[model samples]
Target: MAAIAALSQNERTLRYVIDLPISSTEYNIWKPLFKLFLSVKDDESTICGRILQSLTRRESDNSQISSYWSSMLENGLLSTLIQIFSLSKNDDALTSAFLIFLNLLNEVPQIKNDLDTIKNCFSSMLKHTRSTNNQILTLLGRVLSCLSTDKLLIDSMVEQGLIETLMILIDKQRSSQIIYPYFDCLANVIGKSYEYQRKFIYSKNFLLLIVRSYLQDYDLNLSLSVIRFIRQLVKNNEELQNILAHYGVCEHLLGALSASSKELQQVSIEAIQALSHKNQKVQQILLREHALEQLLNLLERTNMSTLQVAIVCTLWTLCENNPLQKRDVATKIGVRKLISFYTIKSDEHLLVVTDAINELAKCAASINMNIQEEINHAQGIPYLIRLLKSDNEMLVLSVLKNLQLITCAPGFIANRKNQEIIVKNDGIKLLVALMMHAKCDIIQVESAQSLACIALSNNQCSTLIESTLDFSYSHLVDLMHSNDVNVQLKASNALATFVYNNSRVQLFLKNHYQFSFDYFQKFLQNNNESIRCITAFQVVVFCGLINEQKQSVNTAVGCGILMDILRTSQIDDAKSAAAECVARLAHMKSGVPQAIIAVNVIDYLCNLFSSSNDTTIGNASVALGFLSHIPEGRRKLLNRSQTSSIRYFKVLSNNIERSRAAPLSDYEKEQSSTNIMNFYLPNIRQKV
Candidate 1:
């Protein structure tokens, strides 16, 4: 320590001390030497510059430097440095001081504890931000950026007019070196504080000025900084996004997509994504600007996996809920490009790309687009099924979701073809594995839903799913016992759909597992509206599929639970589902219809005929229709008090007949008309 102090007295040998490769054991030597240099008291001393350079060199190890900084802080080094930074007019000294402070604050987060010292230094730092020295301004800007990480320091900096200083520097500064850091400082400081963001945005048209700069500037670094600032500014703030959209920010960002620099394009795409996420107005703005065409063009031309991923994400965000854009993207070969990203081996890339494809497939299925066919034609199924083996739960979930959407297409042929492809590709095995063994509840739920989608309305897929090892009715019953409501809901729904019209599976479940009436009552009585609603639908499917199970289900569930749901459920869908369950029970040959009438469900059914919800009306109509199959139900329908109910039934039947003018075949129309007549006119002559 004494030798180190003596060496600090000679300027020639100080370079050797700075260049010495000190091992970890010798890190203690820096503390006393730092103290000795701080005692020099000369703001312009070369010792200060040499000490700062030595400190910067030792910054490679964060733990060692953090410890060294902690020791130095105990020795009044922060006060001395703030004094040097305030008093020094020497550029090299100021630069060195700023570099050391930046490194210290970045490596040792505990430095934020000394908020008062940093607060005292803000005025000096703001004064230097106006410096003509590019190096001084850049270094000071970075130090300010680091200081912005502390909330209290940011408040103090703003109080000292840091925002005004940064805006001034950004407005007039053209040097990339000077502009980048200032923009970065503003992005960090204001981006973290909502109050500062408001002040910066609403104080003096500062937001407009930044947008103009972003639009007019073409320098790579400056443009990147501006876009990053904008990205952070509007990250989750939709109102600010709309304000930027009013200034045509989306159009300018779309133009950036055509830039030659991949990095610029990537950042620009990210900024656009931030602006357009879930903002339908901004999404429409981007679509009008032909963002779809330009992004697809860039996607085809770019070889960078990251840029491709960004483009795919932006495209999906724009196309979501916008069917025209979804069709346009499909026409522009967007589906093919999205599928091609699966060939990339990087996990991060695969995760993002698969998510995008999943969303795209969802939108396509909603609008009945041929995207499923397109994906299959592009050979995208194998890639998706292959990704089901990924260790990343999110990736596997996304793949399963894509498969679910593909198999659940509205068109029968498309649905069957996709299911066949999945079955042929061993997709069922992978999904069953995830469903049984995945640690994430959400993954298990999604896998179960995907398997259900495959089995929906397809006997082949249903049989295959049932035959898979450990994925039979017993496994689904086990899944229904999980603590997670979502898992239970999905598993129950899967079981319901699995046995829907599949008499063989229904018999298998009946013979294998004891149908728990208490469990079904608990599910129906769950507080969550979705759970109750799905449970009711599950009951409907169960009673409708198997004749032998209806009596037991009716005796156990009773018509009273369905009546309570129909009477008390706030959700229209839940009411409709419960009413449908009542209709299914009324069809049972047992005394279920008599039990339903005992609940005085006749008046409620009559009242539901005037319901505003179409599904409710249809379900109630069907319930009353099935109830009319009995002698007491016919006598109740013919009562003089049920005149309006009878008239409503006649009108609904007429509407059904009018729908025969639709695209239905003669046989379909005849069968549907005959079914409606049988329900309403069972005893019409006796009633009149």
Candidate 2:
């Protein structure tokens, strides 16, 4: 097998008109090829053409042959090729020289690490392109484009009349074999660096040629090259989309929709999408050209996700306020077909399909209907709900995102339809189940958000959710410590709603108060800032809403955590939450006020009274006024030590005479705490 492979390579090498050289400086591999160069003065063009062809072929194979050729060209052999190139008159040797320069300019400098050789070669090619030789001009055009990536080489090319020569070719040259290369050359040059792009962005003749010539051609390669060339012009150039539109380039891009090649179809559609992005008037022009119908037809013939994405991307631009396009897609492309493509595929395809669907949802929801009807028609709602139960974390995230967009997007009729679909497909229950997912925090977070979306709607949906299911409030209680801050936030958000004054919810919380408050204590002590914010939310929600949960079984540890967070947290949200929790507990007749004062809670509240933030100071004042209702708590609230005001309040529970003298009354407690709470609660809300 090895001998046969060698024979195949030998036969391939035998077809070359000149022997391949092996050395850069030495003539060891050069003797025979130089003999051929010396012997074939009349056919030097033929010999050089074959040599260039073999060099390109071996390099394409990515073998060591490119290195060998790089070594040969980096030495004296470069002058020999240039010499032979100058001697031939048919423009054949010029073509061969430019081809070598094209390949060698990209590969040789990279291999030899010689930029001066590249600069010298670029100067030679730039000089040659000024000739009336069309074939030589075509080859040198590619050479100039390839070398334009080097700032120094581009400077030299500009000095040596490269732009003038290209302008002449584009104005005079008619053959696509020549014009195709020049347009492709322009694309390469424009993509090199910002300087080249800036220089060319205003070149009217070059862009006109790019927009004009290839559309009339029968060749797919030429047409596709021109489309890509124009893409290079307008990609990030916000000003050039108008240039493309003014010269009718976008009209021709729309014409690329009928292309028989899938690759051309994809790129052309993408170019149109990129150009028409912020140019809404151009989108109206595309719609007037019936671009939406072409896109609908193309969307049906292809299963390629990329092409599908491109088609929808362009359609999204056209459909913003163009109700005609939206109605057309609804009746023709059939949103059900688009929805049915989601089968829990790879994450890449999921992102594409979901993005397209999201765009389509935005468009369709404006005039026609919500996206859920289409999803329901295709049974996508069921699959998406089942995907929520998937072990693949990415799939779960994708489904949650789609569900969130559909369920949360604004519009009464639209929100009703989407929430109805989720309920009908039992998606709400699945999402509730997903909240317990421990491995993927995104799933837990988004699932909680989706449930919030369903439960918080103002219609009868909340009542439907209230009667339908059994929730794992215990799981939510456990997830309060779920390592992920976002999970903790979302879980608390959902529990706040689930336990919103419903008797069963209160019973569940009353049963699990000890377990739930344990996470709150740990959360308040957590080092993470976000966890601390979550801890604050947890405290306020648990204490403010659930009167039974707030009727306080054990307030010692809870009081310490609340006071520590109030003292330690710099964020007003955390400090405010801790104060608010204490205020709520103090309002109840539980022994919370006695426990709070026993632990120097009065000192924390006194410090907050001097705080810069009005919200913290007010919350602290309300908590103190509520504490002042009790005989022992009243002494702490009123006491002012000679050293620091907060010091006497710190140990006021230990002073028996002061406690007996204060004899607190319920009327004073209710009136004072109510006035302080009413004053601060409004300010506290705006801060949170």
Candidate 3:
């Protein structure tokens, strides 16, 4: 003790004493030694600087300094430092004291980790943020941001009026001096706990006050810090986001987005994105304020992945399900340039870019040609196709949606390049994989519909051959009866394409298929009218082309199902489908006899013939003309004399003759006019 006291008298000796590195030591000696130069009443002017310097020096060494800090904190050394910060007037003294606290809270976390120490520590730091000393306030901001990691200290700091103090600093000060530290303090507190967040959000319009400071045209650094604080505050809190947006604070954020500085632009883009998330009203507000133009401007100026991510994400929020806004963004940032980002960004940013593109595709009716040509020109289809092989369900689902959009666009089919992309990328095989076996029902439904579009675009049946070469016919058939109505419709439509003029496919089904037309006939009665319509369409196509297999269809489809579709369904397409299926079957042996006894399709056809729908009248007339040759069918048709439309069936026969007479031989033409019944009835008589 005598020796240490002798050294403490000299400045150099005292400096050496303060600068000594600490190891695990006796707390009793360390506290008294530290107290000589540390505290509000720090012993010497030079001693406080030396002490902070020693702490700073120790911070640079990647060694354990916590034991030294832990010993001081245990022995009230922290209390002494806080007392010095509370009273010190010298910038050197205050600055050194602030650094000591930052290290203890930030570097030597053992002190902050102790609940009892941090509790008092938080109170002291909150007290210091209100300091008139700018140096103290700045250091306190960083300290609070650090200390806020303790979930336990969250309510303690809020109760100490921390939020109110920070709010007052930013609102009242026009100077940029305390801006970062001021909002940094609030961001720390609000980020720690939801209770604290609500307290700030609901109190004094705390968030709006921070946003107002952002508009002060202060230093770019200060505006960025304020924006960061705003982002941290409302990031996941939908309710608080609503409050800020309601107060028109989101407009200021948009203003910041249009600022000249890139940093402020980046942070503001992030802030707007934070507010726009999951809050539909705020998205509308952002769109109304022309935030999309601001975002495109930023995207053009910046190449940083982080900034690009922010801009892309903001576009995503602004454009989802709102096609007009999507077209607005897509036009400003050309579709070609937008899709060109696919290969440049990392995985995370790529996700944001692709999502923006995906949303834009929703307005395909308006933006189809521009986007389709660019996608084909960019060869982007194969890249999107490969994403379906990913393990991430959301990524794969997003890719499926974009592909679906591309396949169904009107310009997509006419271009042929886009359709070739789907085929060239083996999109059908991937879609079929997701359709039959994906775990999520949504993925299954989307995949099926995508495949159905590809089938519909079969230019010469080449797409069908490419898709169904390794395809599971059984899986496709099974999807026709799936519990999901979308899956059923898509499956039935694909089946129509699969057999359209592809007699090899029909023969293959006949040779290897297990389900009868009965499986298809049952879906005709499904409550969904579209499903019934599509099912009837497939039944007609199948019965029309497979003349050699006509008897099996007649037995499986039967007359009753056809009549039910023709009678019960109000859909014109569905009734037309039933009439066409009935017409196709009328040529087979006993086909008319079955209709007369089982389902009474002739009476339904007669009723169809009297309709105002041109499609219905033509279909009904054709089916009746075929039936008029059969003994029982003619008897049934002759019996329904109640309506003049049915009695005027001969007029329909005259129209069919006139339309077909143009290409017929002279003998056939004369014969067609002689007997309208002879026009269609010969097939029945010849087959019988």
Q: Which candidate leads the pack in TM-score? A: 3
lDDT of 1 by residue, 1-688 (tens): 4335444555346446534677536654445555544454554255656655564456356436533455456656677678766776767667777777777777777877785655467877788866788888888877877777676777778888898888877777767766786777777876767776666556436678766755677888888888888888777778888898987788788888878888999999989988988899998888888888888888888899888778777787787775445645655656787678777655656765666565456431211245667789999999998888888877787788788768763211126778889999999998888887788877876888788878866777887886786775566778778887677777877777566545667777777665555566677777765466567656655664334465556454545566777777677666766666675556543356787787777777666666666446655655665566566675676562346646566644443232222233222244333443333443653376
Model 1, which residues run further than 4 Å from truth? 1-79, 89-96, 99-124, 130-135, 146-161, 171-176, 190-196, 345-379, 386-398, 405-426, 433-446, 452-469, 474-493, 510-688
> lDDT of model 3 at residue 456?
43
What TM-score does structure 3 among the candidates reach?
A: 0.65
Deviation (Å) of 130 in candidate 2:
3.0
Q: What local lDDT does model 2 show for residue 448?
A: 67
Flag the better candidate by TM-score, 1 or 2.
1
**Candidates sorted on TM-score, descending:** 3, 1, 2
Model 2 misplaced stretches (Cα beyond 4 Å): 1-90, 99-117, 141-168, 192-195, 212-214, 259-263, 301-306, 320-332, 343-352, 355-399, 405-447, 451-688
lDDT (10s digit) by residue, model 3, range 404-492? 66654421122355666787767777777787788876677667656655554354424463456455666667776778766676666
Which of candidates 1 and 2 reaches a greater lDDT?
A: 1
Over 1-688, each residue of candidate 2 has an lDDT whose tens digit, in order, gives 2122222434354433224443334434444444444344546445645554454555445565454464355445566655545444546556665676566766565633343454354445555655777777777666655565565555555655666666676777667766666666666666655566676656776667666765767687778777877777676666777777888987788877787888989879878876777677777778788888788888888888777767765776667564445545644655576666564344434543454555444321311244555665677666677667666677677678777656643211125566787888888667766765546766776776676566543335556654445545666666666777667766775675454333455566767575345556566666764455445544544564343354343334445567778778787656766765666456443344577688887777677655544345445555665566566666655453323544323322222222223323333344444433211112222243
Alpha carbon lDDT at 163, candidate 3: 72
Clashes of each: 0, 0, 1
lDDT winner between candidates 1 and 3 = 1
lDDT (0 to 1) per candidate: 0.68, 0.59, 0.62
